[model samples]
Target: MADQITGGCKCGKVRYAGTPLDAAPFRCHCRDCQQLTGSGHTEMMPLAREGFAISETCRIYEMQGGSGQSTYSGFCPDCGAQLIRRSARMGDRVYVHAGSLDDPAQYAPERSIYSDAAQPWDAGSIIKAD
Candidate 1:
């Protein structure tokens, strides 16, 4: 992976950069992710909070995750693009929305989470059928 990764939101607002690729990207299929994204799953890469920097204003939404811990979701104030998420499950780390990356293809997810809450069509295909 590249030494540095950078990206921003849809409207040129809420730009950010993360370094060192702290953790492998993963796909989340939890109902909260599905409902918030209106998609089957959401992809994210965990990085140290200190290594991440944002350039614009963001709206943060805090909610309780399935683990009963706080999950902070951030979005671009202008275009409503999802930017990042910080979960108590991973302290000192924040998960950046993979889709927000300039080259998201590099952050392929190696695992899937919250499979029990995945939709029927998505359940059987959480990971590729290798």
Candidate 2:
């Protein structure tokens, strides 16, 4: 694991802690990520969906992606901060946006997914995934 990365939601309405090395981080430029995060890309860590637990209230909303796959996003009900995202097909894995971390710098883009959809400017923003 990279390190002990523990963080919570903006309002402390939710919390999550994990070993950074336990789940590799990844970056995605897919349209779904872009639309959901309101950013060009989403740099996040991938964890077993069950690995995360919340002490506060959270709500989940599921939507269909451009790829026609279901995408689920979990957010803190109080602050409405998107906390994590995962899909049924990728059920075992949940991707948490690095920005959601109390200390965003704790993680860097480990690998880039959907690179073809990535803007040229968003390229070269990756670290070793292994």
Query: Which prediction has the highest lDDT against the true structure?
Result: 1
Q: In model 2, which runs have C-alpha deviations exceeding 4 angstroms?
A: 2-5, 18-23, 120-130
Candidate 2 C-alpha lDDT tens digits along 1-114? 445556667888788765543655778888778777777788778765555665647788899866678988888888877778888677677777788886787776657777
TM-score of each: 0.90, 0.76
Winning candidate number (TM-score): 1
- Compared with the true structure, what per-residue lDDT tens digits does model 1 show for residues 1-130? 8888888899886888877455667898889888888888899887778768877487889999888999989998789888888888877888888999999877878888887788987786586424
Q: How far is each candidate from the true structure, as Cα RMSD in Å?
A: 1.9, 3.1
- Backbone clashes in candidate 1 total 0
TM-score of 1: 0.90
Off by over 4 Å in 1: 128-130
The alpha-carbon deviation from the true structure for residue 87 of candidate 2, after best TM-score superposition, in angstroms, is 0.9
